[model samples]
Structures are given as structure tokens and as C-alpha cells.
Target: MSVTGAITSGDASLLPGKRDEDWRWTDLRGLIRQIPAASPQGAAWAWESPLAQAGGEVVDVVNGRGRSDLDVPAGGEALVAWRFLSTDGAGAHNAELWVSVGEGGKLTLVESYEGRGAGYLANTTVNIRLAKGAKVERIVFADDHAEGVSVVDASVELAPEAAYAQTVLTHGARRQRIETRVAHPGAGAELRLDGAYLLEGQHNADLTTVVEHLGVDGTTSQLTKGVVRDQSRGVFQGRIVVAEGADRTDARMGHHALILSDRAEIDAKPELLIFADDVQCAHGNTIGALDEDALFYAQQRGMPAEVARALLTHAFVGEVIDRIEHETVREAAAGWAGQRLEL
Candidate 1:
């Protein structure tokens, strides 16, 4: 079935586009050419995780289906790998996952969306629930087909004293959007969200998130960064809400981007809504090119112009990249960033 046919059975009359405030920067209807039929499950895709060193369980999801052969440990620490395999022709793939963490359990999850070929689409939905005192670390990475489109939506709920941390790295495709929504309903919860994007050629990448603080003494911090070149485009939108009676809530969000080429574009929107008088919430957004002075200093040290440029670009987004807890993932992200910058 086509994308229209699959979505028409739902509530919305039209696909989200420029008319919707949340989707204004992204026009999904215009980007998707034709959605192909559901792909048949095939061989398992090859994937590796550094978290395996910690004896963490690994679960793989190929295409839109989960691999039942591997076992997922119920308690303690584990790693779940969400993979989207590539298809041959025009088509769409969808995946929905639900994750629940037991009390005081800790888990590390990775969502990796990638594939080969052209003119395909991928859609994913993720839901996570954390019991009291649980802790979770989530990493998201996307490097899809050059001519493909991808969309992802993730929602999370945290109980009292629970903690959730996330890090994202992406090499954008033709059209891509990854959005997340999180809610804290219990006291003393904490959240940390961080993401980075590297876009080249004519690719487009968007990261949008909404965090709601609904309990007393909740805390949240968010940081996002991007680097766009070769007429590519990057977008970031983050919103934080401190509901009424959610006293002592502290939330802060910051977004920054680097425009490597004159034709490249970057857009950022950070919003905060607070109804409680005892809350502290703030947001910051910035978009600009590399500092000429910094680049010149590196070149003066005998570094080639291209190498200097790469160094400066890496430093710009390294803050978010270095925050990743997985050593293997961190190396992969750094390598991707270097390749994207042509360093």
C-alpha cells in the first residue's frame, strides 16, 4: 500500500506539512515520491555494538520485524539494536517498539536506521516506560540511502527518581525527521538529551523534541548541534513544558549549528512554557559558520587548509559526540563526522 493509503485510515485528513506548526520546516507530502509495499523479512542485517563488552544483551530488528532468535534479558543492563534494512525499489517500511524497564534496572539502547539503494522510505515509533529508580541510556544514529526518506517518533515516560539520557548522531539523507516526546510524572526525575547532525550534498535532517515536566523537583537538560554543507539543510526544534504545580522544575535547552557553505541552511527553534512560579527554564539557539580566526590559527601551525577546516568543524560538534557513553559508538560517530567533513 502507498503512504497515503496507509495513513488515510487514520485520523488526520492530510499528511503533516508546512501548514502544521510542528511540521512547518518539513513537507513530508512533497518529499516522498511513492511508498512501496511492505518488504518481506529477509536475512538478518549485520550489526555490532560496543556495549557488548559489558555483557549487555543485544536485540536486532531487521526490516520492520524483530529477530526472535536472540534472547533479551529482562532485568539489569542490556542493549537493544533497532535496525532498518534497505529495499530494492520504491517502498516504505514501518516499525513500532515498546520498552519497559523494571524498578532499579538499567538499560542502554541503540536505534540505528540505515540501508542502501534509492527511493525508499522508513518509519518507526518507539515507546519507553521507566519504573521508579530506573535508569536508561538511548543512542540514535541514522545514515540512510542517498535518495531515501525516513521518519521516526519516540515517546518516553519516567517515574519517580528515574533517569533517562539520550545521544544522537546522523548523516542525513534526501529527507529525514526524528522527533521525540518525553514526560516526567513522578518527583525527582532527571533527563539529559543530546544530538548532533552532519549533512552534506543535498540532504536534509530535522530533530524535534518536546519534554514535559509534570512532577515536583523534576530536572531536564538538552543540547543539540549540526554541521551543514554543499547546499544541505539542518533543522532543530525543542520545546520544554513545566506544568502547573510542578514546583522546583529546572529545564534548559541549547541548539547550535555551523553553515560550512554559503548555500547551506540551518534553522533552530527552542521553546519553553512554564506554569509554575518556582520553576527555572531557559533556551538558546545559534546558527553560524566556522570562526575565521580559529581556522587561521590551526593553519598557521602547518596544518593544511582542509585539515584545519575539519578540525574546527569537529570541535564544534565534539561536545555532543563525546557525551556518548558507548566507546564503539563514539568512534563510529567521530569517523562519520570526519568523512562528512571530508577531513
Candidate 2:
């Protein structure tokens, strides 16, 4: 199939944009002039990662193809690191990733997307399935090269007694959107989704997620934070649903953003749909600038205004970046966040 045919629902030639409520802020159709064709097989490639682990399995997907090699462990634990890279110039690159965890299995998966481009577009789709009694911790990071545009869509399903947690960190690009859809169908299942974005320059970033609770005693929690500067824009749209019979469901969603420049903008929408009587669901959103009082206090202690601002901004985003379990990954994210702030 052609790259466009594989990524789009019906018409590969058309792209979603402001006409669609889900894409009101980031319009791929208007922003992207042309979608690049898939690179031919056998294109020379090389990948380098800063979060390399000693015993972890690493899978690299370049352009649009990769090795889907994964062994199911009988028991104990497994770690897989999936890396996505695109250097296809002005053309569009497409990639797909799938992960499955068996019953009574424990897995830690890390997926990161980075590209080197002058004006290329990259699209990726990820799907994950968790069996009964399975537990998983997944981390995702997106940092596109200069003037790159990327769109990532992910879906996850959980079985009875399964647990899943995911964290995402994005430094933004010319345009980027990371959308996730999750379903909890098994009783007593739990899900945690958290993300943070550090945007600067003219970059644009959007994080959209929809979660459904379809079983009894299912729980979900989502928290997202963003820091925007210059003329950049950031968006977060989160929705949670509790089915009619999904009793004892507990879900909460929150999004907070910090706007550093008067020209910067942040848009957030958090929604909840509850049909069950015995359910506890709540959501909140907040957008504001840095605390002037805190900045003043830091300056009083003999710190420059710029230093104080950078320090405060770092602390704002550290809450989410620190949640990454892997030490290397967590530290690398922190470093990236700090560097983005020019601290």
C-alpha cells in the first residue's frame, strides 16, 4: 500500500485539519504541502540513542520498516527499547509498532521518536495489548529535528487485572501531535497516562488522548504539563468515558500549561462521560505564567533574572519528566528540558 493509503482512513490524499474538532488547533492538511512517499527498502541507515541500556533489547525503525523481533518470556520480566528515526528529507515517512504482553507477564517498553530534517513529515502508529495479570510501564518521547513535522497515534487495550502506565515528553518541532487512545475492558484494571511538553521558537505541539472504562473496578489517571515560549503553541485534549455497566470506575484527568511569552498560546480541553452510578470522576485545567513572587525571591538571593526564570521553568516541567522510571531516559529528558529552556 502507498504511504498515504496506509496512514489515512479512506482518502490518503486528504489530511485532517481545522474542519475536524479533534484537529482544530493543529491542521495537518493546511500545514503539510505534500506527504512524502515511503522510502524504498534497503536505504542505508544508522541510529544512535542516548538512553541505551545494558541488557535491554533495542529495536530500531528507520524510514518505515524495522525488525519486529520480540520473544515472549515464560515469567519474570522483559525490557524492550524501540527507537524511531527519520531522515527522509522533504518526503513523508511512515512506521508502525505493536507490542503484546502475555498473562502474568511484566514488561517495560520505551519508545522514542527523533528525526533529522529540513522539512520532512513522519507518521507513526503504535498498538499495545495487555493480557490478564499483566503489568507494563511504557515511556514515549518525541523530539523532531529542525523544521520537521510528525504525527503519532497510539492505542492500548487491557485485560482483567492488568495494569499499564505511560509517560511522554516532547520538545516540539515545526508541528507535532501525539494522540493516544486507551480502553480498559477487564475488571480491576488500572491505567496511568502522564505527559509533558517543552516548546519554544515557532514550534507547535499537541497531545490528545481518549480513554474508555468498560469494566467494573477500572481506574485511570492522567496528568499533562506544558511550557510554551516564543510564538509557539501547545494543545491538550483529554476525554474519559465510563460505560453504562462500568461500575466502580475511578478516573481523573488534568492539564496544566505555563506560557512564557505573550505571543505564545496554550489550549486545553478535558472531558468526562459517566454512565455508571457508582463512579468517581473528576478533571481540571489550569493555564498561567510563572509565579512572580517566586521569581522575585530567587532574584533577591543574588540570582540573575534570566537564571531565576530558567530555574523556575525547569522545576515546572521536572514533575513530569522525573516520573520516567529508567534512570538514563529520565536524566536525558531532564537534560533536554533544561537545554530547551537554555538554562
Candidate 3:
């Protein structure tokens, strides 16, 4: 539940830090000596989302304040664009959102975190519940200020034959983490988790996830990639657990990253713990710099040095962007990443 986020309880000691297994790489408890005051309410937070004009009902939360409930009835379908925007005040705030889907329901949830100003702390938690035969596709875009700190936590519960697919794209901030925990009932239910983070300057981004198999016949596939430059840092931690009776469970996890600058850093840990038989599980992790051979090959083709590097980086992160299920949102996400990649 606590994923290195600033403690809204105003008790700095409650913040998660290096002592927590899931948060050892991120030390929020030591980062904040005092919880900041709540951000001012009713501020002039006005902005328009690019996806809003395309389609979908717009649910906006400014400075951690606003409407936060989205529910779909049985056999129904919906499209929603959930946006969280912060103010210029260097304060602390938190928001909670609940999403429920009935049997046979489908939802496309496009979430975004747009933070403004510097030296602010924010936390957000989203709880999702899916009935039998339900489906949910979530796409997140997070662009936080270089000096801001934030954490986003998600807890998911799925019924039999349910499917939850999510892809997160973020240009991290001073201390930004997105943590997700999923309970897979393992009755033909499925899960797909993917992420891509591009951080520059002194920014930091952490993507942590845990998946637990409660029954039989569940599957999970996860892939995460990142590119850090200019002394930035990126973290990825994924753990999958299969219970004793969770048979026929198939799961795979992979994380890869690129370090463009000598001072940049990336920490990755992928683990799979199986207590059941007849299950297939594996994990892979890699951290390195740009492929010099590929860079040389690109330069041989007459591409400028900077242009070639940018092109390669863009293509590297493109795999994650291309996995977005929605067409319009996919294009929008590509453009957003393209601008950041300077491609």
C-alpha cells in the first residue's frame, strides 16, 4: 500500500524507505523530514488534455481534489480520461480513486499525472475491482516537474475470466514511483503489465509491481524499459508468486534499460517465486548503455550523431508505446514520448 510516497498522515516516520523490501531502492522516509501542508484548494488549475478533444468523458482532479469514482455496469462499456494536475504551490496532497466493473463490462481508462511547479509532494492511490468476464485496459502518462516528488499506487482484484492490461509511460521527477499490486484468482484470468520511463537531469522514476496467484490457470506477462540521461536514475522491481495450488500458471518478467550519461544509473530486480507444480515462470534483467555497434551502424548510414542516438532511443522505447491497445491514445502517447525524446 505504501510505495515510497510522502506520508499524508503528516508523520514522516510512516513513509516507506530503504527498510521496506519493495522500497529499498527508494528512501522516502529519509527524504522528507516533515510532511508538507496540503496544497491550496480551488486554485486556478486550468488545462486541456489532448485526448479529451478526441473522445471519452474527462475526469479531472486538480491539486489532489475532485471527482474520483468511475463505475461500469454489467455488460456495459465506457471510455474515460482521468487527469491529475497540480498547482504551483510547493505543498503536499493525496487523492484516492475507486473503479469497479460488473460482469462482462469493459473499460478503457486513460490516466495522466501532470504536475506543475517545483518542490511539491503528492500521492495517489487507485483501487480497481473486476467481476467475472470483465476487462480493463489502463494507459498512464506521467510528466512531473523536475523538482517535484510523487507516488502513485494501484491495487487490483480480478475474478475468474477477467483480464487487466496496463501500460505506463512516464518522464520521472525528483522522486516519482508507480507501484501496482494485483491479486490474480488464476481461473483463466490474465494480466499484462508494461512500462516505459525516460528521465533526464536529476529526475528519478521507480516502477514496482507484485502479482500473487490465488488459484489455478492464471497468466502474467510483464516488460519494462527505460532510458536515463544527465545523471537521472530509474528503478524496476517485479515479483510474481504462485501459491501451492496455483497450477498451470505461466508468468514472465523482463526489464531492460539504457544509460546515456556516465552519471546516470538504473537498478533492476526481477524475481519469480513458485510453490506450485506444472507452472512455467521466468524473469530477465539487463542494464547497459547504448549499443555502440548500433550507433556506429546508424552513423555509417549518414545520420548525424545526435540524430542517430535519438533515433535509436526512440525506437527502443517504441516497443512499449506500440503495445498501447487504443489507436487514438496510442498515437497521442507516441507524440508525447516523441517530443520528450526530441525525435
Candidate 4:
């Protein structure tokens, strides 16, 4: 399969604007300018993922184009499609995966991104709907090359008493962003978002989330943590909005980042917009270097300096991993983090 297309003029317009309130801090134009024209490349490389045969709905987007080899679950259905067009110096390639969970159904959807060409622009969108009392666990892994620009847009709607959980893991990329918007339109909905990013070199990764409490007695929680080394940069912006009619809404948002080098950077913003007087909402964000006191304590106890640093870094990210309800996934994620932090 060859994944290449024309270069659309004014494609930058399709990309998010910096003037937009949500992307004010990020330079979208500058980033898009760095991407070269897309070209079709031969599909000579392949990846084997445990998620490939996990049995629900599987969608693969390789190098800004969609793949047609997909298998739906026995009792599930999927809508798969692709969109490609050119604008100017840039282009837009979107692979959409939509899944509908039947009543009291249990499903797992996994979307993975892997790019081949360097300096190519890629954008993807995923939409999911869970029926009443249904349960869905979605996992997104962005293991793109170190020289590609990628963005993922995910929107989910939860039915009454439905349960939804998502885990996002990203490695280093030239520039990467993942945005998730979740709405609890039905009463007593439960939603949780957990994410982790491992960035090094000059790579950049951002995870932004907006969760809305629109129904009475709904609950939502989000925990995002990241580790940036060298001159890499990471950003986490999360907002929880509670409607006036959502009297019994409960929501919490937390983000933390660990800066490993003097040149590394992290920008964190956690906001809560509440309109219901009876709702309980809170948000917290923290960005700083490793804890010197704890480091000194470990060093005094005869631990090597490098070993102490790794221990502290692990503890910082462990809080986010602990929130993963699935034991197997949580252990695998933790192991991946441990190997990445090896010093």
C-alpha cells in the first residue's frame, strides 16, 4: 500500500488556529510550515500489536492514510472511512473510526499510529458511542517516527450509567498533540481519562482534554503525567465544566510534569469551570524539577546519584499509572516507562 497524496493549498486553514482560545499557546502555523509535502511510500515495514487481535474494532492509520484490513467483533459493528485533500503547502489526512456499543455490551477499541516518512503532516479523528449500561475501554498509542507531525482528535459520548475509560501513551515525536472531548449527556455516567508521555531530545507532545458534566449525578476524573528529558517539551491542559442543571456532578482534574534537564520545559494548565452550586469540582497542576530533599535522602542512604534520580522519576509517574484499572495494561505501561527511564 502506498500512502501519499497531493499538497493542498490553504490546508493550514484546516489545521487549528493559534488565535483559537484552545490553541493560543501552541504555534500551529509554524509547526505546519515545518512539514513537507506528502509522498506515497511503499509499505515494506509492518508492526505486530497485541491490540491487533484484541477482538472488538481495530483501525490502523499508517502514514496519514487508512488501512482496509479490519475485523469487527462477533457482536459489534464499526464504521471505517478515510478523507484526504490538499490545500496549499500543507494537506489534511484523516482516518475516522466510529464504533457503536450495543446495550449492556462490552467492547475494546484500539487505535494506533505509526508513520514512515519524515516531515509529513498527519491528523486523525476517532468517535465512539456507548449505549445505556454499556462498557468500553479504549487505548490509543502514538508511536510515530521522531520526525513527523501528528495530531489525534477523539470525541466520545456516554449513555446513561455507561462506563468509559481511556489510556493514551505517546513516545517522542517531532511534534505531537492529542485532544479528547468527552460528554456525559446521560445521568449517572462514569468517565476516566489517564495519559502518560515519554519525551526526549527535542521532541514535543501535548495532551489536552475537556470533560463536560451535562447530566445530573455524573462523575468524571482525569490524571495526566509526563516526563521530559533533554530539550524536549510537554504540555497538559485539562478543563472540567459542570452545567447548572448538573447539581450532583463530581469532577477532578490533575496534571504533573517532571523536568529532567535545565533546557527541558513543561507547560501545565488545569482549569475547572463550574456553574452548578451543588457540584464538587477541583483542579491542580504542578511543574518542577526532581525533589532535591528526597534525592538527598536517598543519596544519604547510600544510593547512587543516577539511581536516586530514576527512583524519583518513577515515583512521579507512578501516580498516573496507578489509576489504570486494568492490571495487565497497567503493568505493561509501567514496564515500558521503567525501560525508557533506564540510566
Candidate 5:
């Protein structure tokens, strides 16, 4: 079946609605009104350094069409490439990319999302498989326009003794949502996810994730942070699920948001589901305004309020930024955040 058909027929199961448990918090119905059925013009394509490296495969999706010049590594299996277009004036198109790493092999996947104009929706998905003893790092970046709307879905499956890590960065749009799902299908696996969102003006963004421990001796960790300014809105919802047979599982999840204006808003919900007899899993969520005491102290020390707030916001999001293993990627993300905050 076609991608658009699958979504409209409820086969994808990620549609936004009250019946969908994972999408109950953020409604996509309202955002659909802003997207147009036809594609827009003047969509520019550019690849900055660090992201254009040839070591790993790079996949670029523009308005739901897939384009890539990177060559697949030798011995790689089950790689898929396709484009998804939107119909019925929904203003959203989705493309799904799949990569399966071989046993004891390493793979890096980079996915980029860019848009053209207002009333455009781009929904993209990436699936990664790590065989036994294999390792993979996945990085995703979204540079959508101010009037664009985007939704990204990423899923990873880990085998025994495998490692999977993912980092996501987004500069807010009219409405943007990123959802991640990770599952450990074999014992002794590890998964880590880090995400950051910077929203300004009337833009809205959300980062939601779910990690399922289906194997014994599996571990997972996730940290997400957001900065909302002007009249923007940010949301983060994360869940960790430990199956009955998955003993010795260790999982932790946390989300923090900094609201920079009275008009700005943030909503966070972190959850844990444990069916195992012996396991350690916890989750936390926090949404608060800038620290008055800290701002006052900084002011007393001759620092301006704007500078103080910027510093604190940077520090909050920097936690995830520091976890990025690549120095050049980390610096690029930090620079993007700084530009968004006008700091």
C-alpha cells in the first residue's frame, strides 16, 4: 500500500487523535488546516559541513521526497529508500528510510528535514536495526521554515550486546512533532536518546519517545530539553516499558522546559511501565519559568536580565548538547540554538 494510503487507512497507527494513546496530548487536527495540498516553490537545498561527511550515509527528505548521494556501506542489508507525498489537502508527506546493520558492524545514519513554504507538512520516518555486537549512531536535524509543519518518527531495534544512540535537534516551526520508539529484542543491549528543541514566535514543537525493554539485561536512558519564547509552545512526553520477562533492566527518562515569556507555554509528561519482577525504572518532567533568584543575583552582579535568562536557558539545553559525541555536530547545534534565541 502507498504511504499516504496507509496513514489514511489507519495502518500507520500514528495519526493524531484522542483514540491514539501516544498522540492524545498534542492534537494534529488543528495543525492540518494550515497545510496545503499542493507543494510550494523556492525550496532551497544546501548541505553544510560536518553533516556532509562521507563516512556515514546521509538521507535528505524535502517536502516528503527522498534524495541521497551517499553510498551504502558494504555488506549492509535491508536498506529501503522511497518518497511519500501528501494527498487530500492534508499538507503533509512522509518518507520512511530503513537500514539494517550486520553483526559486529557499525553504521551511522543522518536524516535531514527541510521545507518550502507555508502550508507544508513533512512527516518522515527512519528505522534502524543493530545486529548482535553491532553499534549505530543516528542523528536527526530539522530546519523547517517558520510556516512549515513537520512530524518525524524514528524506531530502532537492538540485538544482543548491541548499542544504539540517537540525538535530535529542531528549530521550531508553525507546528513540529518528533516521535521515537526503541525496542531491545535481545539481551544485554543499550539504548540512549538525547533531544533538544528551540521554539520562538508562535511556533510549536514536541518531542515524544517510547522505549520498550523486551529482552533481559537491557538498559535505556533519555533526556530532552526545550526553550520556548514569545508565544511559542513546547511539549515533551516520554515512556519506558519493561516487559515481564525483561529482568535486570535499567531505564531513566527526564524532560525539562524553560518558558521565556508569559505568553509562552510548556507541557511535559514522563511515564514508566514496569511488568518485570526486578527492574529499576524512573521518569520525571518539569516545566517552570526563569529563576528569579538567579536572575536577581546576576543582575546584582551587573548582568542584564536578558543576558541572565539567555545564559540559564543555554545551560538547560546545553546538558543534552554536551552529550553529543561529535565535536563539530555539537558546535553546529549550539550555534543554531544561539541564533534562534538571538543570543
Candidate 6:
């Protein structure tokens, strides 16, 4: 049912492409003419892992192999650093991981995707479950090889009274996509999903998410912002579906981006489907260049052109970075973006 599934199983027939509505922009089948050979096992992570200095239980999946599950006991609290690393440029591989948080448990996840080498393919799938009254915050930073292709799919399930929040940041690759789907069982549960990307060259990045509210009194909030230069591309697809009888569901989704070059592209689709008459749902999308007046204002104040541009861009994307709850993780995210924007 996934590109990773087809690649690992050698079933090209199952690959997703332009024919599939969700994968049209990504078009994995078209980009990959032939699946590469299987990747070798036991590749080491040699880069400075994100949030590594913060210190926590480290779980690494190298070359698609490592511990595949994590659990937080009832009323427990945990801080974990989960990493996915790809070091081979010759072939394709995949990994699947599961995380569970018991009732009243709290979990903070600092995740990283460390990919190296060129012309490789990598896929990762994660499933998360939260019991009633549980709380979870996941922050994912993707630093992949610019010449490689990568995809990440995550599914989240939340029981009544549970809360889940997530933010994803990526620099993009030859072709990279991150998809998140959430199953929301209302009864006062809450969800927040956010993403930010800085893409350049001919690279591509896609952030897609779907949240389905099956019961009453659920709330969901989503926002995504991206910046692209050269001929690179950025895509954001967000959909929220509230089934019949799912009354009092409040959901809002927004996608905004800035294109710094005439050749760059940004595609966004934000949708809301409400079967309940009393639900409140809305969606918005905006794609354009930076604020010219603001840029000029900063320059007039004595800042150089590049400095002014970087300052404005940083403030624009900093909204999402500021949402990261962990202090160390938030600073790390800002530093990553600042370095990319040359701030």
C-alpha cells in the first residue's frame, strides 16, 4: 500500500504515481524507473545528530534496521532521541517503528533523519498510539542527502482526552515526501500539526497530512510554511474530515509559502470535509514572494540586503519553530533554519 512496501517486496505494481491523487505531485513510480538493489545492513551514523548534545535514550535505525518499538508506562514521563540514518548510495531500504504512551504518560520525541550518499532511496513508517489522558510532542528534523530520494509516513491514533502535537522540518532532497495521518476519537481530544521547509536547487519536498474526526468535540489545528529558491518545488496537502454525528468539531488548516526565484514553485491543497452541520471548519492557502515593503524597510535601517532578507525570512518561518515545546529542541530548530537562511 506504500512505495516502501512495494520497493522492499519487489512489487512495482504497488508503487504510487501520478494516477494516485495523494501521490500525484510526488510521483514515486515515475521518478524511479527501476528499484535499486537492497541496501547492505549495519551502516554507521557519522554526522552530528540533531539534538545529540541534549542527551536522552538514543534509538538509531541504520540502513533500515534497529529497535522498532518504544513504550511509556502509565503515568510515566520519557524523553527520547529517535534517529533514522541512511549511508548507502547504491540501493533502497525501509523501516517501521511503533510507539505507545499509556494513560497519563508524557513523551517528548526528538527525531532526526540523517541520510548520506547519493542516488539512494529510503522509506520510513511510524505508528503511534496514545491512551486516554496521554500527551505526546514529536519534533522531526530531516537532513537528507540532496541527491537521494526519501519518504516518511506516520500514523497516529489518539483516544478520548488525549493530546498529540507534531512539527516537521526538512531541507528537501532529489525527491522527498513526509505524510502524517491521524485518527481522532473525539470526546475532548486535541491535535496540532505543523511543518516548515527550506528548499533550493532542483530538490522537491512535500508535506501531506489527513486528520479524521470520528466523534464529537474534537479539535485540530494545522499550519505549514515553506521557502523555495532556484527551480526547487514545495508541496503541502492537508485534509480534515469530520464524519456524521461528529458534532462540535473545530478544525482549521493553512498553507503559506514564499518563492524567492521565478523558476521556483509552490503547490498547496488544504481541504475540509464536514458532515456534521454544527462543526466549524476552515482552510486557507497563500503562495507568493517575500514582503517587498518590509524588506526595503529593513535595508533603510542600515542592514545589508542579505541580512535584511534573512531576518525577514527567519521571522516568517520562526512561528512554526517557536511552537516547539522543548527549549533545547526549539533552539536547535532555530539554529538549523538560521544556518540555512544564512541569518
Instruction: List ranges where model 2 is wrong by over 4 Å.
Output: 1-13, 40-49, 69-71, 74-76, 88-90
Can you list the residue pairs that collide in candidate 3?
Answer: none
lDDT of 6: 0.90
**Residue 315: error of model 5 in Å?**
1.1
lDDT of 5 by residue, 115-161 (tens): 54566666676677677887776666776777866777777788899
Question: What lDDT is reached at residue 314 by model 3?
Answer: 90
Q: How far is 1's C-alpha from truth in model 3 (Å)? A: 9.1
- lDDT score, residue 81, model 1? 62
TM-score of each: 0.91, 0.92, 0.96, 0.84, 0.85, 0.97
| Model 3 TM-score, 2 decimals | 0.96
Ranked candidates (TM-score, high to low): 6, 3, 2, 1, 5, 4
- Which candidate, 1 or 6, would have the higher lDDT against the true structure? 6
List model 3 lDDT by residue over 1-343, tens digit each: 3533435557787788888878888888878788888788745355455687677688888888898899999999999988887778858888889999999999999988887888788899999999999999999999888888889999999999999999999999989999999999999999999999999998999999999998999999998999999989999999999999999999999898999999999998888889999899999898888889999999999999999999899999899888888888889888888899888
Task: Compute the lDDT for candidate 2.
Answer: 0.81
Candidate 1 colliding pairs = 36-91
Residue 134 displacement (Å), model 4: 1.1
CA error at residue 210 for candidate 4, angstroms:
0.9
In terms of lDDT, the poorest run of 10 residues in model 2 is 1-10
- Please give the lDDT score for candidate 1: 0.78
Of the candidates numbered 2 and 6, which has the greater lDDT value? 6
Write one digit per residue (lDDT tens) for candidate 4, span 44-78: 24335433333333334444455533333434544
- Model 2, 1-343: lDDT tens digits are 2224534433344777788889889887777655655454434245445666345787878776786545445355888888777764535667787778888888888888877666767788888888888888888878787588788888899999988989988888888889899989848898989999988889889999999899899899888999998999999999998999999898989898999999999999899998899999999999999999999999999999999999998998888877777677777778777777788
Name the best candidate (by lDDT). Answer: 6
Q: Please say which candidate is ahead in lDDT: 1 or 5.
A: 1
